[model samples]
Target chain A: MLNFLSTALVPLLASLIVLAGLRRRLDLFACFAEGARQGMGSILSLVPTLVALMVGVEMLSASGLLELLGRALAPAARLLGLPEALMPLVILRPISGNGSLSVLGDLIAKNGADSLVATAGAVILTSTETTLYTAGVYFGSVGARDTGPTIPAALLSDLIAVLVGGGLVKLMLFS
Target chain B: MLNKIWAGMILISTLAGLALGRGAELSGAVFTGCSRALSLAVTLLGVAAFWSGLMHIAEQSGLLAAFAGLLRPLIRLLFPGLGRGGGAEQAIAASMTANIFGLSGAATPLGLRAMAELAKGQPRGMASPHMQMLVLINSASLQIVPATVVALRQEAGSAAPFAIMPAVWLTSAATLVAGVLLLRLLTALARPRRQRASEKGGLRRC
Candidate 1:
């Protein structure tokens, strides 16, 4: 399957990407219209979720909840050799990749980027998804809310990514 | 939230132990170390806001659609669940946007916005499950540019920061395929048991 994803899927998908540019299929404009409509509609909701999550995280920081979460998750983080504070970022990364990228930036700087720290940060870049983001936009567009076990499953999957990322980095880059 | 702090404590202690084991004078200096991260976090909050907003604007302006038009069939193949409908086209397009650009942060709000839009008239209870599918797919996300990784390598002063792109591409392939397979397997395994239980319970009896 992995072989297919890389050898077959990626190449085929990338090559077919040229089809989008064929001047005849002006449907590009329509899709943009669709995206714009979707974007405008969600702007209002974005305000609340952003404010709530950002403020909640900030509050967690001030209230020492961040620290507590770190300690509690230390064993788990150690298993991945990640910083406990990284947990929140891990949680947030899948929801907001750029936000986590920004966080990973800070981690790299502090840890002397060339070390395992930077390498692990890089692995995280490849691993995990933005949970809230994907769900919100996809479901809102289609109007489906029955998400089933996607959340739990994705979380578990990302956790595995964290471990794999750390292990790989430790061997290739850090070591 | 307070209870979650234990993880941090453990991490700090482990690092401290490492510091001590290494006999470094700066051992147990996590407080001093994270100071940089705190300051950076403040700066990044704005950066995050800007980038996310930019992605929204891009999506709004049709940049993503242009990209999506290019990859429709392949995406359809990857996300058969999304089908070939208009929404599937858009969803796959948005995903492609996030992946190619490495806008990991921007993808979240956009993803949520995507789901809300997708669920517009889906059968009532179907909303949550479909949204979960979106999340899972996003989590198993693939990347090409890997801006974050490059940034980390540069910060670390790597000899060739972007050299690892090949590895990243390879690993992402592995993870994505594995993740999809795992989810499918789990779902398939759970279906019968769920049916049995649901049969016993039923939705209603007139």
Candidate 2:
């Protein structure tokens, strides 16, 4: 069942059913085309910001800045009772989901399925999001100028999630 | 603020790259990064377009309204600025549902549409409180069923992959609750400051 959903077949199946059901009242193709056009336009407008952010992120990661930051934060992670190795996962969790997902896959492979680190990684991933990416895309789409308090709020939430995830794993599995 | 962050990222990365004596690597990363972003946009174009269309059908079929009705009370509290029974509410509800289901891919278009709606009639540079709430809520997305994590565990040969359900549920719920409370607190704190500014005519622009 999880595998079935993993393929995104569930949403696709549901969309097909919905479209088929609505086709009589609405011109489904026309609606889809209009929506697709709008989506494309937003995507095109967002390319510049996306490229800027992605390049920044890539440089940070490739230049070993993330590793350096992760190393510096290791003690804090340890203080939260999580493994020091999870430092990278915590650091990368909010910036890029793909980066963190790969890190998570590696952690699970290295530490086994039911290990505390892997469990915490899964929980953290579920709890948090790709903050910078989502904010950039969403705000860029809407042309909202002031991120205002959103970034700080999101980062704080990510920090809390990381701590709570590790704490929960420690209490539930370790204790 | 975004400009500063962007500039800071480039500056810091470049300096770090040069300090680490990896100038060649950093220069290469800029091109690779742009290409990666291009591919991402292309990938998102397909998903966003399909979902946007499907969402239109869902909206037309009244399915989205039903979903909105289900989540109305909570959404109403978060978006008091929106008028009653508005389409934006439906879009937001759909996006929130998708987020909960770990369908972030499908949620993007709906989320973007919601922001577009929320920003309507508002000043160009200012994000409404409601918009901030939506972004913060999305940032702390609560996944009830993390299918990807479960699948990853299964692939790793976990005997019972669902065993992590308790931890996932706890973490996500806790984060969401904390996020809402923090947003409330921050907004309350900001209100007085804004009220004072209004007296000085600074609030007229907003």
The Cα local distance difference test for each model comes to 0.56, 0.74
Q: Write the per-residue lDDT of candidate 2 for residues B9-29, one digit (tens) a residue.
A: 789989998999989889888
Q: Give candidate 2 misplaced runs (Cα > 4 Å).
A: A1-71, B1-66, B194-206
Model 2 residue A25 CA deviation (Å) reads 16
Q: What is the lDDT of residue B175 in candidate 1?
A: 66
What C-alpha root-mean-square deviation, in Å, does candidate 1 show against the real structure? 8.9
**Model 1 lDDT per residue over A46-165, tens place:** 443333333333333444445667788889887767757667677657656445654565456556665565556666666666655554555555545445556556666676677666
Worst 10-residue lDDT window, candidate 2 chain B: B47-56
Error of 1 at A98 (Å): 8.1
- Judged by whole-model lDDT over C-alpha atoms, candidate 2 comes out at 0.74
**DockQ scores of the candidates:** 0.17, 0.42
Candidate 2 residue-wise lDDT at B5 = 58
Query: What TM-score do all the candidates reach, one by one?
Result: 0.58, 0.67
